[model samples]
Target: METSDLAALTDRARRLGADGRRRVLGIAGAPGAGKSTLAARITEGLQGRAVLVPMDGFHLAGAELERLGRADRKGAPDTFDAAGYVALLRRLRHPEGQEPVYAPAFDRALEEPVAGSVRVPADVPLVVTEGNYLLLDEGPWAPVRGLLDEAWFLDADPGLRVSRLVERHVRFGKPRPYAERWVAGSDERNARLVERHRARADLVVRLG
Candidate 1:
């Protein structure tokens, strides 16, 4: 993406008050595309004005996945509670005259989604949610796009993404061969599905 677009994106977030009533900013991309990193950077720059509500927080609990016999398909789009994620987004978009809406957060240490771990306070505006399927228009994820005020799709070199996946898996205790296999079989599939939604984004962010 051009430098002017990032400036505009940041400006848009800046214009939203810290009152949790403004529209949300969505960033969608395939696995290892730096959605989280970009989201974190933007929110961090705001210094508490923006909060990141990542889609990974909606990942099905490990135990639930095992029970459903889909633990092997962890990164698959269907593996997540897409409907629940949409519901949460709806609530965030329109916070009722109540305390606030709290969503789950995925704990990397536990490899599970912990309920009520992220509290989107009633006063914090500019929700920066990033995920692979935000721009995807199918199934439960279809409703997600309409809820977002604006969205960006991140593009990166495929080789860089593959390398990042391999290192990620290795950090999680998998051998190099197994890491490569997981990246090829699981992550790659998710990446392909995510690519189909790139056209739905408002801007294309190419990571340099």
Candidate 2:
């Protein structure tokens, strides 16, 4: 079923952690579709019982993207370290004895991934991971769906999503014109790819 109630969503996440066994809940969405925002809210609602591990942290460094000639399409599936992200999911699912797990974080200001920026304590019961490709069924992304205990796909109006992406890019220092172009060109292309996998999610969330 589709829902837009934030309180109900947060309550659902709370129940996910009630068993005390570590479980991962994934929030997948297109660019500017609110994946990170939803993940953070869920994590905060859990009151330290859950942690946020974003898939953006697995983005290939700018230099590597340039070397592979994929810099222009930075958010595409091929531009991220997909396997590494999957491996981290596995580790979070089954941690070593009494040890905390560390995950990378993306630094939006630097436009780079910072290694070991998130620490998942051994006692946290839920891990909320968000990304664009969590429900993708191709190549390395195929394993991600199985790793998640529950997955939610966020869908938003196309025009609103594009506008959010433009504002985000401009806020991050891109000129308004370039931000608009990049959102229309790169972000929208990836958004279409992500939207195709919507049926794979356990739930579909529509935000107003």
Candidate 3:
């Protein structure tokens, strides 16, 4: 069933504590799976004590992708800097006594990543992070599996996922045909890859 209320998540976070014992929650799912939406809702329900750090901020820039001939494989597992993301999460896992930690954020309008977009205060105690590969057991992503306090895998109907991807691509300026191609080629492929990781997650959530 879909979980809209985050009271359970927040209560768990409070018990985990911050500054080395903070609860780090991970919501993993494929493209159009609503991972970001769920993370945002959890953080919002937790009020000011919770902060979100998305993995999308680590996406390679368009220019860089062109240089590497990877622009066409934008949503592939290889398109992101998984190591960098893990390193940042590692740092957050052990927050200093009273020092805040900063994390990057992705800009939808500029289609770029910005540094220091989210500042997680020292005592906030709860961190909700969402991404596609969080449960994947490959490469640098392998280490990510051992970091989270609780990992959730989200599942949505394939048709709905495709529809959402097409709408999002068009809203982001891609032509209809190009958007469909991306959803079929890139997004669909990534979805299959992520589905294999559902077994590794602590919970599997179904959403419409």
Candidate 4:
């Protein structure tokens, strides 16, 4: 979490995109391991050379989840639009004279995806994407690993991560007891799934 570490990551991002082709950097971690925060910091440090397209944007709609009987495990791997996410990544990788590729953004307030909310310009050299399942090797998630130039896994103390997740759920309007129970149940399951693929990452970053 040092400034120098972020600087190094920024430099690495720059180099990955130096060959005149767009580079995708993926940040993967457990539910509350701070992948999104690290991705934002790295993109900010890169100045304007990078854009962020988060995996959360591909979260399936509430209605869709309910229809599929997955509403109880909304954050699980199967609850995402994995194929759509892969297709978007493919498009981002080879823009080829097309206009800026618009990506979806997740709206936490409404718990839905807003289409075309993020614009990735043709000239942007880097795309930083963060999510829990980037390193997952099962089903539709397996292809995600090959699309990224570099993948980083963020790790943190289990108790601290669980606390952060609980607070986040509370901030998003869940009651304290419900939030704690959800984290101990659904989020913990997803966290373990993510952890199983940690060794596949190019870098494993331990955050305080």
Top of the candidates by lDDT: 2
lDDT of 3 at 166: 96
Indicate the worst ten consecutive residues by lDDT in candidate 4.
1-10
Candidate 3 ranges with C-alpha deviation above 4 Å? 1-20
For each candidate in the order shown, give its overall lDDT on alpha carbons. 0.85, 0.94, 0.84, 0.91
**Can you write out model 4's per-residue Cα lDDT over 123-152, one digit (the tens) per residue?**
998999999999988899999999998898
Show model 4 residue runs off by greater than 4 Å.
1-4
* Residues 161-203 of candidate 1: C-alpha lDDT, one tens digit per residue: 8898899878877899998998999999999999987988888
Clashes of 3: 0
Give all TM-scores, in the order shown. 0.92, 0.98, 0.92, 0.96
RMSD of 3: 2.2
- TM-score, ranked from best to worst: 2, 4, 1, 3
Clashing residue pairs for model 3: none
Candidate 2 global CA lDDT score:
0.94
Off by over 4 Å in 2: none
What TM-score does structure 1 among the candidates reach?
0.92
